[model samples]
Target: MISCSPAEPVVPKEGGGNRERGAAPRWILADFDDTLAPGDSHAGLLRYILRRRIWPLLLLPVIALGGVVYLVPSQRRRGISLIWWAITLGLSPLGWRKLVRAYCHTRPGLFREAHRLLEEEGHRCWVLSASPRALVRAQLALQRPANLPYRTIGSRMHYRLGGLMPRFYCHGQHKLLPEICALDTELALSDSLHDLPLLGLGEQGWLINPTPARLEKARARLPHLMVKNWQL
Candidate 1:
């Protein structure tokens, strides 16, 4: 293996040492949400809109309409409940995801660092997640790192009639192992126990904040698996 430390100082210069060593090439695989961003992007967006926009614009309006409905008699209020329900059902999920993606531009520095390190080491990198592609793509666009490879594999929704029609959640062998095999990644890094299939594909694997029970369990399941902490 090539030395990864800095080279020795030329002519033994004072207070100086050799140039820093470079690392070997390895593929990087990451999970989104808690692994990259500080928190759940999907939830964060919903909470922000609920607290800032939806509650006030929707709940307040509905409540005000309800109070007036009692005074205005039941005839005019026939469609008011239906209208309120429709508004709530429509605006809630839509507004929340939009706002969350906007607010979730701030991803974790640790994950970014890991990404950079693996990339600089000339490893292929990819994100494997269960999040929808729209959300993941939005976040990835914002967190574009110069040194890292660009690839995202995640859930996607099929739309019809101007609304969500089908939901796809990327998990199990469908999500993890396939990507690992396709990329031929030598190493995989992840924080969740569900990433076992992906980790098994790697020549070596690193788990972040792995619980003791999970570690033991993983080792038992993957006898040849190599485990290490993800410093970045």
Candidate 2:
């Protein structure tokens, strides 16, 4: 099972603690998939659908088409996510939760050292992901240790006419929307170069488990980012 080391206490500085009262909170913007979990929630969900035979093999073509759509530029990824949501619209909320919880239970080794280091430093952490908000929230709720506190921001889903629908796709550059951009982000962590825009929002960044080519590209684009190897 996934577990966390004991958190070190945050010592207040002299003179009744450091910094002026009402200072802007420092936050660590972290990616959910790969950064926290061993696998992607979206991919896990797809695997569940396949294993359960919830849909016929005929639907695979449509799913493949959605994947193609995701590769297109100019906000098309949002459309692709929406398509996937529509395809899975028949699943009840309780059923969805069960699937997510089962997936979370099987994935161990979450809360990596990098995560511990950030939290130990007393930074408020927020998970930022392109994955559907409900799935991300469910996984975090199951996997996160009680001692660690965190908030999550991800693509939202809306229930309309008794079906779940995509309300937002928080991926790529969209991860740095104005609401998120306004935060006093001290650091950001991510595995994919797609998160470069989000990484740029933070004063410092860490690229986790990136390919050598991707690392070189990120270094060229973000010279100040620290690269770290993380086994997932």
What's the C-alpha lDDT at position 183 in model 1? 55
Q: Highest lDDT, which number?
A: 2
Scored by CA lDDT, what does every candidate get?
A: 0.52, 0.67
lDDT of 1 by residue, 10-43 (tens): 1110222333567533456667665555456644
- Residue-level lDDT tens digits of model 2 in 93-203: 777677767766666646567446544742388788878877777766565455343667887876665545567777777776666666766777898887777777667
Give the total clashing residue pairs for model 1.
Answer: 10
Q: Which ten residues in a row have the lowest lDDT in candidate 2?
A: 1-10
Please count the clashing residue pairs in each candidate, in the order shown.
10, 0
C-alpha TM-score for every candidate: 0.58, 0.80
Give me candidate 1's TM-score against the actual structure: 0.58
